[model samples]
Every structure is written in C-alpha cells, then in structure tokens.
Target chain A: MELVVSQLLTGLSIASILMLVALGLAVIYGVTGVINLAHGEFVMLGAYCAWFLQTEFGLGLIASLVPIFIVLALFGWIIEALVIRHLYNRPLDTILATWGIGVMAQQAVRLMAGGELRYVEMPAALSSSVNIFGATESAYRLFILGLALSLFALTWYIYRHTAFGLKLRAITQNRDIASSFGINSGRVYRATFAYGAGIAGLAGALVSPLKSVSPEMGTTYVVDAFMVVVLGGTQSLFGTVASSGILGELSGFLAFHSNDTIAKALVLLAIVILIRFRPQGLFAARVRT
Target chain B: MNLTGKSAQQTLLYGAFCVAILLVPLFLDDAFLLNKYSRYLVFAMLAVALSLSWGYAGILNLGQATTFGLGSYCMAMALKLGTVPVHTGSDGLPDFMVWNNVTELPWFWAPFHSMAFALMAGILVPAAFAALLGWFMFRGRITGVYAAIITLAAMVVVNLVIIDQQRFTGGFNGITDLAQFEVAGLAFDAYSSSTYYLVAFCLSAVLLLSLAITRSKTGMILQAIRDQEDRVRFFGYDVALYKIFVFAVSAGIAGLAGMLYTIVMEFASPTFLGVPLSLSVVIWVAVGGRQSLLGAAIGALIVTGVQGALSESETFLESWMLIMGGLFVLVVLFLPKGIAGAFEMLAALFLRRSAAKVPSVSQPAGEAITHGEGAS
Candidate 1:
C-alpha cells in the first residue's frame, strides 16, 4: 500500500511537469491551430536561460524565472512576427518551419553550451524530501506540484474571464469572423503565441533543477507534450491537464515495472492507435471551420 | 514550342547528363574523388526518392531514414550470410551480432544468404511497408499536418523499436564488415576503381529511370495531388492509390540508395535511421528544389559535402547546424523554389538578354519545363 502511494505521488510529481510543458502546447494548438513543433525548444531555451542566469550571475533559482520568461516571451514574439506570421495559413508549413526553428534553437544551444549535459542545482529549500501521511516525497516534487496547480488555476482564470483571453478564444473560433469584429487578430495571434512560449519557458525554469539540462533533452519532452495535447484534444486547455495526468501516471506506472524505452514505445503505440481511430482527437469537434 | 517539343529536348538533355555521369570516373582517375562522387550519387538517389513523395505527391515522409536503414540492413544481412558459411558460428554471424550474443540465427535472416534474395528483399521490404502505411493513412483521409505528424511519430517509434530489438537486429552497434562481390567471373575490385565505377554506373541508370518516371503521366498526376488533393479527388481519381504508388516507389528508390550506401560506407548503423538523417534529407530536398529530380540530387550532394566539411572542422561542427537552421529559415522565406530553381531562373534571364544576338535555338516546351520549376 505504501509503495503504491509512493508511486502515485511520484507519478503526480512527474505529471505536474508534463502538464506545465504540455499546457503551452495545448494553448498554441488550440488558438493558432499550429502544433508549434518548436514549443519544446522554447521550453528547452527557458531551462538553459534560467541555468545560465543562476550559474553565471549567481542569481537564486526563484529570481531566475523572471528573465527566463521575459527572454523567451520576446523570442516567441519575434518568431511570431517573422517566420510564424507567414505560416498562419499553412499549418503543415508552420509545423515544418518550426521544426527547422527547433533544430536551430537546439543547435544554437549546442554551439553556445556544448553538447554535454549540464546539472542545475536545486534551491536548498526545495532540495530535501518531506514525510507525508507516513510516506516521504521529495520537497522539490511537491514544489513542482504546487507550480502546476497554480499555473492551471491561472490559465483557467485567463480563459474564463480575462478580456485578452476572450479575444484569443474568439479568434480561435474563427479568425476571419474575429478579425471582422475589429479584434486585432494578428496582434492576438502574436501575443497568444508568445504567451504559449512563455508558459513553456516558465515550465522549463520550474523543471530544470529536477533533470539534466541539455539541448537535445527537449525532443523527448516535446514529443510527450505533443502526445498529451493531442490526447487531451487540441480544442481545450482543460483537456491537456486531464490527459497529462492520465498519460504521466500510465507511463510512470509502466516504467516502474518495465524498461523505460519499452514503456515509451507502448505509450507512443497507444497514441498512434488512438490517432488512427480518433483523428478529431479526444476533444470537442467544431467542424474544423 | 508545345509540350511534345519540350519533352524531346528534356530527353536529350537527360540523356546527355546520364552519359556525363557515367563517364565521370573515366576522366577523374583519382580513387578518392571517384568514391566520393559515387557516394554522392547514392545520396542523390535517396534524394530523388524523397522528392517524389514530398515534391510531387505532397506526402512529407519524415521517416525516410527508416526506409533507407531497412534497405541497408537487408543488404548487410544478405552479404554477411553469403560470405560466411552457415552454422560455423563466429565467421557466420556479423561482428555486431556476435557481440550481442545469439546462439542461433533468426528465421528471417535465412533467405539473406542468397545474394539475389537479399537484393530483392532490401527493396521489397521498404516498398511493402510504405505501401501498407500509405494505404492506411490515405484511406483514413489523413492529410497535411496530420500526415507529417504520423511520419515523424513513425520515425521515433521505429528508432526505438530498432534500438530495443538488439537480438535479431544488432541494436545500436549495427552490422558492418561486408565482403566484396564477384559477379560472372568479373572481379568487381579491378583497378581498385571498378567498384566506384560500378556504383556510378548503377546510379546513372537509376537516375535515368527516375527521370523517365518523373516525365510520365503518372508524375503529372502525382504533382496534381500536391497542388490540390481535394480537387484531384473530385476529378474521380483514387488519390489514395496514387499516393500509395508514389510512396511505395519512393521507398523502393530509398532502399536502392541504402543498398549502394552500404557498399560505399561498408556498414549500416542506427544513425542511418535517426531523426537527424531524416531531417537532413528534408533539408536537402528543400535546398535542391523538390519537384526537380536533378535539383534534389544536387541538393543532397551539396548538403552532404557541407556536412562533410563541417564535421572535419571543430569550429564548423559547433556552429554549422545553427547556420543550417538559419539557412532553412532564409530558404523558406525567400528562395522557396530551391537552389536549382534559382539557377534556372537566372539562366532564363540571361537567355532573354542574349536572345536577340543569337539565333533562336528551338526546343520543345516539355523539355524546357525541366528548367522551369517554380511555386506553381
């Protein structure tokens, strides 16, 4: 019973990071209808930026998040203004183009930092494990859980009530109709893209301490994020959070028993099977207008 | 002036190009350059395969490396079995397989002992896989971004599977150390340059065949599918079958390249099937010009050459991928038609300027169309 409880908690912790990384992917796909293949690269850059700030400037981990978000946000905006702007009408082109961008980002990181994996130290406060309900969990794991839930609440609040969120939602429904209503669709597109990237950046900052920071590590998570967003249905942010838990738990539980590679393969196979059957994804169908 | 005239000129140009390619080793007696050119030709074959599906049929196969790898493995297995006697143990199994530990060979590895069967299997396996995958994908009416995603997913999954199945297949440490061939009492290794000549000879033949296919009515339909798949469907053509046909044929060509690649490199590893390789193929096709077979070939050669040069320099290795990414962005933004197309456009402009001074060299429109690839 204790082992199961421990496994569940561990799964929850991993799911939290997955949820955060996948949240931005879901938002970008939902709003812009582009998968933002570079979404993982944004997350990757975020982690690197935070690590660089901490290592170079001797900034505290908490203090490093601000610049990480800001830098990635600006980067996202530029990507939107330049390459992504022209790709709005061509979803496949956007995917391939962003794939190129992702490669560029990865190679840029490789060039700057070298290909070796860099370890980021956790803040002292979040480094230790804590006893909970006669079981122990890493303090950092709990911290990540807190971050995920808070972000989930924050995204929910934005989509539910905020004016910018409303405008974004309106654009998602029909870009032509939304633009017709005097909504600056282009600005909204850029801002939403930046926002999505920023969230991924924040997620990267939050998760950097838990894992090794490397340029290519993002490919694995990026693929996981794609699976989560698609499984949850690209139509809804709530779907991402829900699906993240399912996928994360499933994968974690499988990994607990089997080899990590096989577990990953099984998960991928499941996604492929699901995609084959449910091309519309596991969310609301809107006639693809 | 019309399509027939253009086609005739294209045929002549293609014939001349093939002859020139076949005669390369004769003029360039240097063994190193001959080998390099031969490998480039193999890469060009793979590029042609990629262009057919991507540039014409509009199915961007992000997993071209998988098919290429399949072909390589088939060739490697066949050669390994053919050279060594069965049940002799160490001499029988390839070096990687011996290291991986297998008491007995798998049943599938049986037929590879025969050279002819191995050659056939190398091409057939990839073609079969492509046809089956294409059928399922197209029948489901999956198009555009979804198809791209599926192929990318296939690459990841296939790579993982290949990594795991180390028993039957030599996991990451792939099959290597293939023996040389002797056909019809002819020493393939004559002059140490004949091997390269053989490769170059085969490549030109394949290139000619590829050009023929591209000029056929089938090629026209494939290009039509790329432009507007739905409209083509409305015209009462089976879009799925057309896609499957091109995809299968492309996979066969990729396999052929893999066969030659094994000969040139004398080894096959998981790196051949990795995402990096697949992405490089995409970059090559994009840089060369997708619709033009010659352009795809040139793109492969140029990019591979760049990669070769870059890897040799530590500084270039660090920054080259970044430059490639930047180039990708620039190409997409500006030179969407690719390097070959850019050259042709320049040639046309020069021709226009000099038209009054020189007599009109009559060429058919069909033939001229080879040099007229644009974003139509």
Candidate 2:
C-alpha cells in the first residue's frame, strides 16, 4: 500500500512537470495552428534565467519566476511578430523556422553560458520530505503538484472566461469569421503565443531545481511536451491535462517495473499505436466541417 | 517526350554535374582529400533522398537519419565481424559483447557474417522499416507537421534503444575499427582511389536513377498528389500507396548512402541517428532547393564542404551552428526555392533577353518559362 501510494505520488509529480511544459505548447498550437518547435528553447532560456538569477543576483528561484515569465513572454512575442507571423499559413515552414530559431537560441545560450550544466538551489522551506499514509514524498514535489493544478485552473479560467480568451477561441474556430466579427486576431495570436511561452518559461524555472540546467536540456523536455500535447489532442486543454496524467503514470509505472530507457521507448510505442487508431487524438471534439 | 529548351538545359546541367564529379579524382591526388570528398558525395546522396520525398512527395521525413543509421549499423556489424581475431575474440564474438559477458553471438548478428547479406540488409532493412512506418502514417492520413513529428519521435525512440542496448550496439561509443570493404578479393582501402571511385560511381548511379524516377509517369502522379491529394484521390489514385512507395524509395536511398558512409568514415556512432544530423539533412535540402533533386545534391556537397573547412578553426567551429541556423532561416524566408531557384531565375532572364533579340523564337521562350516554373 505504501509503495503504491508513493508510486502514485511520483506519477503525479511527473504529470505536473509534463503538464507545465506542454501547457504553453497546447495554447500556441491550439490557437495559432503553428507547432512552435522553438517552444523547448523558451523553456531552456527560463531555466538559464533561473540559474543566472540564483548564481549572479542571488535571487531565489521563487522570486525570479515572474521576471523569467515576462522576459520569455516578451521574447516569444518578438519571435512571433518577426518570423512566425509571416509563416502562419505555412505550417510546414513554421516548423522549419521555429526549429532554426531553437537552434539559434541553443547556440546563443551555449555561447553565453558555456556548455557546462548549471544548477538551481531548491528552496530551503520545501527541501524536506513529507509523509502521507506512511509514504514519504518530497515537499517540493507536492508543491509543484499544487502549483501545477492552480496554474491549470488559472489557465482554464482565462481560456474559458476572459474576453481575450473569447477572441482567441473565436479566431481558432474561423479566422475570417472572427475578423468579420471585429476581433483583432493578430494581436490575440501574439498574446496567446506570449502567454504560452510564459507558461513554458515558468515550467523551466520550476523544473531547474530538479534537473540540471543546460542549453540542450530543452530538447528532451520539448519532445516529451510534444508527446503530451500530441497525445492529449492538439486543441484541448482538458485533453492535455488528462494525457499528461496518463503518460506520466504509464511512464512511472513502466519505469518501476523495468528501467528509464525501456519505459521511454515503450511509452513512445504506446503513443504511436494509439495515434494509429485515433489520429485526431484521444480527446478530439467532434465538429462539422 | 519532345526535346524542349527546358529539358535541353536540364540535360546540359546534368551532364556538366556528372563531368565535374567524375573529373575530381583526376585533379585531387591526395588520398585523404579524396576520402573526404567521398563522404561529401554520400551526404549529397542523402540530400537527394530527402528531396525526393520532401520536395516531390511533400513528405518531410524528419527521421531520415533513422534509416541511414540503421544501414550504417548493419554494415558496421558485418565489418566488425570481419575484424582481426584480437578484437572479435577466439569465439568470434565482437569485443563489446565479450566485455559485456555475452556468451553467444545474438541471432541478428549471425547472418551479417556474409558480406552479401550485410549489403542487402543494409539497404532492405531501412527500406522495409520505412515502408511499414509509411503504411501506418499514410493509412492514418497523418500528413504535414504531424507526420514530421511522428517521424522525429520514432527517430528518438530508435536512438534511445540503440544507446540503451550498449551490450549489442557498442552503446554510446559505437562500433569502431571496422574492416575495409572488399569485393572479388580486392580490398577497398578508405583512402584509396578505388574507394573514392566506388563512392563516386554509386553517387552518380543514385543521382541519375533518382532523376529518372522523378521524371517518370509515377513521378508526375506523385507531384500531383503533393499539390492536391484530395483531388488526386478523387481521380482514383491510391494516394497512400504512392506516399508509401516514395517514402520507402527515399529510405532505400538513405540506406545506400549509409552503407557508403560506414565505408568512408569507417565507424558508426549513435549521433548518426540523432536529431541534429536528421535536422541538418533537411536544412541541406532546403538550402539546395527542395524542388530540384540535383540542386539538393549540390546543396549538401557545398554545405558539407564549407562546414568541413570552417570546423578547422576553433572559433568558427564554435559559431558554426549559429551561422547555419541563421542561414536556414534566411533561406526559408527569402530564398524559398534556394540556390537552384536563383539559377533558374537568372537562366530565365537570359533566355528572355535573347528571345527579345529575335522575336521569331519568342513562343519557345514562353514555353520554356512555363516548363521551368512547372518543373520547379
């Protein structure tokens, strides 16, 4: 019972990280219909920022989160305006362009920070383990779970309730119709892209304490996040959450039984099989074209 | 079947390319330089393979390196088996297997003892794998970015598996100190003129064969499908089959290049199957002109040559990726058709100027422009 409970907790923690990394990707791809391959680089930059702050300015990870978000969001906004905006209709070109942007960002970070791995100090308060039903869990893991849920709630609220969210949805449904209804889709897309990038940055910052910070770190996370987003259904927030949970649990369970590498390969195989049956994804909403 | 001015120009260009490639060994007597050029030719073949699928069939297989890596590993296995008994042990097991305490040679590596089997498997395995993957993806109607992501994901999975199974695959260090390729009891040394000629001969064959395939009736239908799949399907073509065919063909080409790569480089690392190399292949094709097979080949040659030269300097090596990334972005943005497109534009302008000089041939000039545009 203790092992099961602890395993579940581990799964939840993994799910939180996956959700955080994939949330921004889901938002950007869902609204803009552009697969931002550079999404991972944004996450990498956020981790770098966290490392920079902790090392240079002596700012705590928690204290520097907002600034990292803003900076990454602004950076994302500029990228969208300059490159992605031109390639909106050209989805394939956007993939190439974003990949190029990712390469440049990775190289730029390597040039500036050197290729060495950097670390972020965990908060002293959340460094200890907490016991639940005789299963000891890291307090940091629990905190991340709570934070991820709250962020999801916040994102859901903004996506469902706000006027900006409505415009964003309007554009997603039909860009021409949304424009006819006087919605400024370009501005909304830019905002959506920025928001998604901000969320990814925040994820990077939070994950930095757990993982080593490096320019190439984002590549792994991005691939995982993409799997989450793709498995979840490209345009659904709830789907993203559910898929992250599924994948995280599946991976965690598999890893417990076997090993990390085998678990990963198995998870990818499972996703591929699932995609074969349902190309529209697990949570696709039916609509008449 | 008519010999139009456009076809004549294409024929001329192909002839010139062939002549240049064939004449290289005559001028460059340095064995090391010849070896390096052979590797560049292999890269050009890879670009051609990518162009066939991506440019013609609109299937941007981001995991092209998967097939290439598989082919390389297959050949590497065969070569490793043929290595000196010191490396293979008294029982003839690979040194890595012996180190890992593997008592027996695995079933898969057994057949690779025959050079013919290794060579055949080198091409067939990747092609078969690609065909199977293509079947699944095309049947599922996973096109565009989704297909690219899936292929990329598949490559990652394979890369991880290869790295994890260190006992069999030689893990991160990969298989090294391979035996030289031989045929009819004649050894082809890596730095020998014969090896260079072998690579050059294979490249020329691949180039011409690909050109022929692209100009065939099936090729036209494939291009039609690229332009409008739904329309082509409505007209009764098996769209999925066509996609799978082209995809498998490209994979086979990539596999052929991979075998040559193993011979030239004399080793196969996991990096051969990694994301960076796969993505670099796409960039080479894009910069060459995805729409033109020969253009894509030239693009790979030039880019690989330049990268080789640039890597000689420490500072340049450090910033090379950044430069390539910037160049890729610029190419995609402004020069979407790439260097080949630029050349075509210049040729078109020259033709128009000459046509204006003699109004009698203006009709042929107009026809040539349309043909050029259509081909591109």
Candidate 3:
C-alpha cells in the first residue's frame, strides 16, 4: 500500500512536468498547424535565461520565471513573423524550417554558454519534504503539481470563455470563414505561437533544478513532450492532461522495476504500439470536417 | 532509355561523374585524403538513398540513420570477432563483453562471425525492418509530419535500447578496434587505395542503379503518387505497396552505405544512430536538391568536404553548426529546388536563348522541358 501510494505521488510529479512541457506544443500545433520543431530550443533558451539571471543578477528561479517567459515569447513571435508566417500551409516544410531554427538556437547557446553544464539552485522555500499519507514527498514536487493544474485551469478558462479564444477557434475551424468574419487569423496565430513558447520557457525554467542545464537538454524534453502531445490527440487540451498522466505513471512504474534508459525505451515502444492501433490518439475530439 | 535530348544530357552527366570518381586516386596521392574522400563517397550513397524515398516517393524518413546504424553494427560485430587476440582474447568474445562480465557470446553475434553472413545481414536486416515499419505506417495512412515523428521516435527508441544493453552492444563506448574487412584472401585496409576503389565502385553502381530505378515505368507511377496520392489510388495503383517497396529499397541502399561506413571508419558508435546525424542527412539531401539523385549525392560530398576543411580552424569549428543552420533555412526558403534545380534553370535558360534564334525548332523542346518541370 505504501509503495503504491509513493508511486502514485511520483507519477503525479512526473505528469506535472510532462504537462508543463507539452502544454505549449499542444497549443501551438493545435492552433497554428505548425509542428514548430524549435519548440525544444525555446525550452532550452528559457532554462538558459534562468541560469543567466540567477548567476549574473542574483535573481532566484521563481523571480526570473516571468522574464524568461516574456523573452521566449518575444523570440517566438519574431521567428513566426520571419519564418513560420510564410510556411503555414506547408506543414512538412515548417517542420524542416523549425528544425533549422532549433539547430541554430542550440549552436548559438553552445557558443554563448561554453558548452558546460550549468546548475540552478532550487528555491529555499520549497527545499523541504512534506509528509503525505505516510509517504515522504518533496514540497517542490507538490508545488509543481499545483502550478501545473492551475496553469491548465487558467488555459481552459481562457480558451473556453475569452473572445480572443473564440476568434482562434473560428480560425482553426476555417481560416477563410474566420477572415470573412473579421478575425485577423495571422495576428491570432502569432499570439498563439508566442503564448505557447512562453509556457514552454516556464517549463524549462522550472525543470532546470531537477535536471542538469545544457544546450542538449531540450532535445530529450522536446521528444518526451511530443510523445505526450501526439498520444493525447493533437487538438484536445484535456487529452493532453490525461495522456501525460498515463504515460508518466507507466514510465515511473517501469523505471522503478528496471532503470531510466530501459524505462524510456519501453515507454516509447508502448506509445508506438498504441499509436499504431489508434493513430488518432487516446482522446481525439469528434469534429466534422 | 528514351533517346530524348534531355535524357542524352543526363547520360553524359552520369558518365562524366563516374569517370571523375574513378580517376580521383590518380590525381590525389595522399592516402589520408583518399580515405576521407572514401568516407564522403559513403555519405553520397546515404544521400542518394534518402533521395529515393524523400525526393521521388515523397516519403521523408527522418530515421535514415537508424538503418545506417543497424548495418554498421552488424558489420562491426563481425569485424570485432575477427580482431586480434589482444582485443578479443583467445575465446573470441569482444573485449567489452568480457569487461561487462558476459562470459559467452550473445546469440545474435554468432552468425556475424562469418564475414559473408555479416555483409548480407547488414543490408537485409535494415531492409526487412524498413519493410515492416513502412507496411505498418502506410497501412495506417500515417502521412506527412506524423510519419516523420514516428520514424524519429523509433530511432530514439533504438538508440536508447542499444545504449541500455551495454553487455551485448558495448553501450556508449560502442564496438571499437575492428579488424580490416577481408573477403576471400584479400584484405581491404581502411586507408588503402584498394578500399577507396571499392567504395568508389560501389557508389557508382548505386548511383547508376538508382538512376535506372528513377527512370523506369514504376518510377513514373511513384512520382504520380507523390504528386497526387488520391488520384493515383483512383487509377488502381496499390499506393501502400509502392510506398513500402520504395521505402525498403531506400533502406537497403542505406544499409549498404552503413556497412561501407563501418569499413571506412573502422569502428561503430551510438552516435551513428543519433538524432544530429540523422537530421544532418536530411539537410544534406535538401541542400543538394532532393528531387535529383546526383544532385543530392554531390550535395553530401560538398557539404562534408567543406565541414572537414572548416573544422581545421578554431573559430570556424565553433560556428560551423550555426552557418549550416543558416544555410538550411536560406535553402528551404529561397532555394527549395536546391543547387541542382538552379543548375537546371540555368541550362533551360541557355537552351531557350539558343532556341529563340530558331522558333520552329524550339516548340517541341520547350513543351518537353515544361512537361519535365511539371512532373517534378
């Protein structure tokens, strides 16, 4: 019972991170119809921002999060305007273009940061452990979980209740019709892409303390986040949450029994098999074309 | 095969290319330079393989390195067994296996003891895997970005599994200190002129064979499918079968290249299956012009040669990736047809200018040129 309880908690913590990383990908892809392969680089840039701020200006991770988000969002906005705007209709080309952006970003970071592993100190307030139902848990982990859920709630409210989201939805449904209805789809897409990038930056800043900070670190996170988004169904936000939870638990349980690398391989295999059977994904929203 | 003027020009190009490759050793006396060129030849084969599926069939396989790595490992395992007693010991197990406390040779490594078996497995295994994967993906109707993501995911899975199974696969350090490739009684040293000739010969054969495939009737149908899949299906073509066949064929070529890569490099590492290498292959093909087999091959050679030269300098080494990245972006945006496409455009312009002097002679030729452009 104790093992199961602890395992569940661990799974939730993992799920929170997955959710945070994937939320931006889900938003950008769902709305813009661009894969944004540079999404991972955005995460890497966010982590670098946190490291730079903490070391250079004595800013804490928590304090630097907002600035990191803004910086990444602005960067994303410029990329979209310069590159993605031209290739919106060509999905495959966008993948290649964004990948080029990602490679450039990674190399730029390597040149700037000297290719060494940089560390960020965890916040002192969340450094302690908390007793939860007889299983000791890191307060930081719980905080991440809380923050993830609140972010998801905030996103949902904005998506479902806001006028801007209504325009976004209209554009998603039919770009021609949305424009006829006076919605500036290009502007909405830029904003959506930027927002997604900002969230991804936040995820990177948050995850830096848990994992080592390096230019290559984003590659793993991006792949993992892609799996979560792909498995959850491309268009469903709630699906992203549920699928992340499922994958996190599965990986945590497998890692417990075996090891990290093996667990990762197994989880990838499972996702591949699952997608083979259900290509539309676990929670595909029913919509008529 | 069609004795058209364009076809004649293409044939002349191929012949010139073959002669240039064969005559390299006569011009360059340095063994080290010859070996480097040999490696570049292998990369050219890989680019040609990618061009077959990505350029012709419109299947962008992001995991091209997965097949290449598999083939390399298969060949490496055989060579590892043939290494000197100092590395493998009298028992014939690889040194890493002994280090990992693996007392016996794994079952998979058993067949690789024979050079013939390893060579065949190098090509066949990756081809078989690609056939199965292509079948699965095409049957499911997974196209575009989904296919790219799945293949990328598969590559990562394979990479992780190989790294995790340290005892059998040598983990991160990989299989090293491989013996020279020997067939019958002749040994092919890595830096020898003989090895260079072997690579050049194989590359020419692959290039010619691929050109033949691209010109065949089936090739026409494949191009039709690439342009309009639904229309081709409507015309009674088995779209999935065609995709699988081309994908498998491409993988087989990549596997052959991988074996040659192992021969040239003298070792195999997990980096062979890494994302960066795989992505780099796509960049090479795209930069060369994915629609032209020879163009793509030449693109790989030029890019790789430039990279090697640039890596010699300290500042260039630091910013080579950034430059490549910028090149990739500029190529995709402004030069989507690549260098080959640009060359074709220039040739067409010259032809049109000469034809303008005699309007009657240019009519049918102009139509032909436009027809070829439309097909691409």
User: Per-prediction DockQ, in order?
Assistant: 0.45, 0.54, 0.53
Question: A1-289 in candidate 1: lDDT tens per residue?
Answer: 7888888897898789899999888888888887787888998999898889888998877888878888888999999998998867656567778888999999988877888888777888878899877789999889888988898888889987999889988888887899999999999889888888998998888888888999987777787887787678778777788888888898889889986677778887777667667766677446555
Return the lDDT, model 2, position A5. Answer: 95
lDDT of each: 0.80, 0.89, 0.89
Candidate 3 deviant stretches above 4 angstroms: B1-3, B87-89, B357-376
Q: Docking category for candidate 2?
A: medium
Check candidate 3 and list the clashing pairs. Answer: none
Pick the winner on DockQ between candidates 1 and 3. 3
- Comparing 1 with 2 on TM-score, the higher-scoring candidate is 2
TM match of model 3 to true structure: 0.96
Chain B, per-candidate TM-score? 0.88, 0.93, 0.94
Better of 2 and 3 by DockQ: 2
TM-score of each: 0.89, 0.96, 0.96
- Residue-wise lDDT of candidate 3 within A199-236, one digit each (tens)? 98999999888888999888788888889987999888
True contacts kept of 3: 0.53
Best DockQ among the predictions, by candidate number: 2
Model 1 agreement with the true structure over B1-376: per-residue lDDT tens digits: 2569767876787677678777777678877767777777788788889888888788888789888988988887876665664435654765556566776677899878787888888899999988877776787676776677677766777777788888877787777666665556655542357777677677677667777777788888888788777778999999989899988999998988888788777777888888778888888888998777778878988988888777888888877878887787777666766997798778766776777676545545535543332222
